[model samples]
Target chain A: MTNWQEDIVLDCSGLNCPLPVLKTKKIMDGLDSGQVLKMISTDPGSVNDVAAWAKRTGNELLETVADAGEYTHFLKKRH
Target chain B: MVETAGKKKRMALIASKGTLDWAYPPFILASTGAAMEMEVGVFFTFYGLTLLKKEISPKVSPHSNPAMPMKMPFGPDGFQQIEWPIPNILTGNMPGFETVATSLMKQTFQKKGVATIEELRDICIESDVRLIGCQMTMDVFGFSKDDFIDEVDIGGAATFLEFAAEADIQMFI
Candidate 1:
């Protein structure tokens, strides 16, 4: 995967369901189009949640890395 | 995407239980749905109306809830820890176990870094999750509109079903 410059890095470790997604959306809402976001979540549900959120919101999923119970995702704002 | 700004997918949930344990599901799903850019609504009915009450911080009653597992203060962090399961016979003998269990649950959630019910409610409201208090339940329970928190809508079953009928996801919790 290409290294896209992350405009925002959201650390969602220790957060359970709904929080990771909610905080991600809140941050993503403030980002400009074409800007990138890097989100790290400890919740396993976020693996599918972030991907689905990207798909549902028309954002571009650039990279994803899962390491030792933590998930890292890079997404670009589409609109 | 251009034409679908306000026309995002919708989700509706019926909250029927008022216990602390029962409160998590509806708000969790509703808040996540809103985060996913969907319109979310949670209709509080029956005993669930207590969830929307302004002064009531609902507590779990382990006296009747046998399914709630007791959590240790520590997680499974590669260190092997022996867990001695307490016999229900012993627990049943202990008085005031319900209060102890309820506080324990709250402590466990705090230790796990999970949000409290108050925080989750705020998140749901901020994320645009519509909170509708069942009017019939309120009337039966002698609760007025002022009994609930701000930003709550009072409605009946038909009102909730209207949103549920068009929602992609409908839940009865």
Candidate 2:
């Protein structure tokens, strides 16, 4: 609900571990530096996984929003 | 472990099993490691070398595994949650039981939105994760380089050790 902007949207709902992170990396690879991506996932594990993946891959995780059972993450591609 | 500045972390995994249930760990870890920007290599040896075949149909046999739960992939939630206690004798002696179990497991994985082993292996290859097949195993099993997918590199133990020695994480699966 915040005013964050994104250059691409990836929906990974119903997918499990590694898939979410894998798909996120695939999309991020195609994005230009500073471009933002909004990814939504239904896997509860992704809450921590996204943060860890962002840190390890040097991407910036702007914020994560949990709405009901779904978790939405906003990430910026690293320069 | 000493952290070398500006060097990517490396992971080395040895896969030695070929069962459907056991085949997942190496590919899953390798692909994920690559996604995390780590250098990853998976050495396939013994029965695990079969996983590198162009057409792999790994089957699960719950005959000796007492802890494996039998669950249906379809039906109502309550029905699906109920684990059927299948006798080991039937699972072990019944012909085509392994095929049934394999299909059921695949169905459950599909229902749960899990990726197939082949899909994960494709991701590993796409991410440049090094897949090394054991040359000794290939010779013993009469497997030629053409028998496996094009992405696999055939090597001996020394090749795997060379990569694993520098790896931050090493696993035997």
Candidate 3:
């Protein structure tokens, strides 16, 4: 519904690999656990980078969607 | 660029022997910062510069400190099943352990098609993340300016300390 962790939009446009996760950590820090963080990234590798980071960092991968020319995903801080 | 107001974002990858875990933190954090739109810098000193060395590691060390970041604990057949330096001081405690992790990371990235450190370095420059090589460490390690990857500025603890002071996130790997 409203304020899902991913709903907090963090548009990481030009940033590549490790940055997406790093950025996600920064944004997530401001929110409570169970809240979602939505990320909009242009880097192709971000698809896997974020996924791997979420797993490594103990975050939740609520969703990962790929649009025409972009990748979007939601990460919920579980820890 | 969107302003990350009140964002407690800062990092210094203070690396000593440049082992597996040590190498990843700074860059991983640095890249993470750029992604988060936070200011990031990498201060490579001592053996830590080994990660940024022109040549990356080839494979995991089957010998010393064999356990390392511990292969992520995949399964019985996975690399983590092996032994590594647990609770041991990273530097010199397990010689060659850092080397193994460094190279294995590179190989993993290469296998995964992740961006190389050199590539990440380029992105760091564009994102305004400072990439500084420790002058003192370089000298002691007998590393010439040429030995390091390009586009790194030379500085010592003071230089990095300034960053660490302002940085909300700092890691000594």
Model 2 docking category: medium
DockQ preference between candidates 1 and 2, better one: 1
Q: Is candidate 1 or candidate 3 better by DockQ?
A: 1
Best by TM-score: 2
Q: Write the per-residue lDDT of candidate 1 for residues A1-78, one digit (tens) a residue.
A: 567789889999998777788888899899999999999999888888888888888888888889999899998999
User: Candidate 2, residues B36-88: lDDT per residue as tens digits?
Assistant: 88999999999999999999999999996789999999999999999898998
Residue A18 in candidate 2, Cα distance off native in Å: 1.4
Error of 1 at B7 (Å): 3.3
Model 1 lDDT tens row, B1-173: 33466688899999999888999998888877887788899999999989888876777776565665665555575422444466677567788866777787788788666788888888888887999999999889898888789889989989999889999898899
Q: What is the model-wide C-alpha lDDT for candidate 2?
A: 0.93
Q: What is the DockQ of candidate 2?
A: 0.55
Which parts of model 1 are misplaced by more than 4 Å? B1-6, B74-93
lDDT scores of the candidates, listed in order: 0.84, 0.93, 0.67
Which sequence of candidate numbers ranks them by DockQ, best first? 1, 2, 3
- When superposed on Cα atoms, how far off is each prediction in RMSD? 2.6, 1.9, 9.8
Please provide, for model 3 over B1-173, each residue's C-alpha lDDT reduced to its tens digit, 9 standing for 90 to 100.
21333554566667655654345556666766665545677787777767667775423443454454545333455564565545556544677765655566666556444565556555566567777888887788788888876767888889989888887677776
Pairs that clash in candidate 1? none
Top-scoring candidate (DockQ): 1
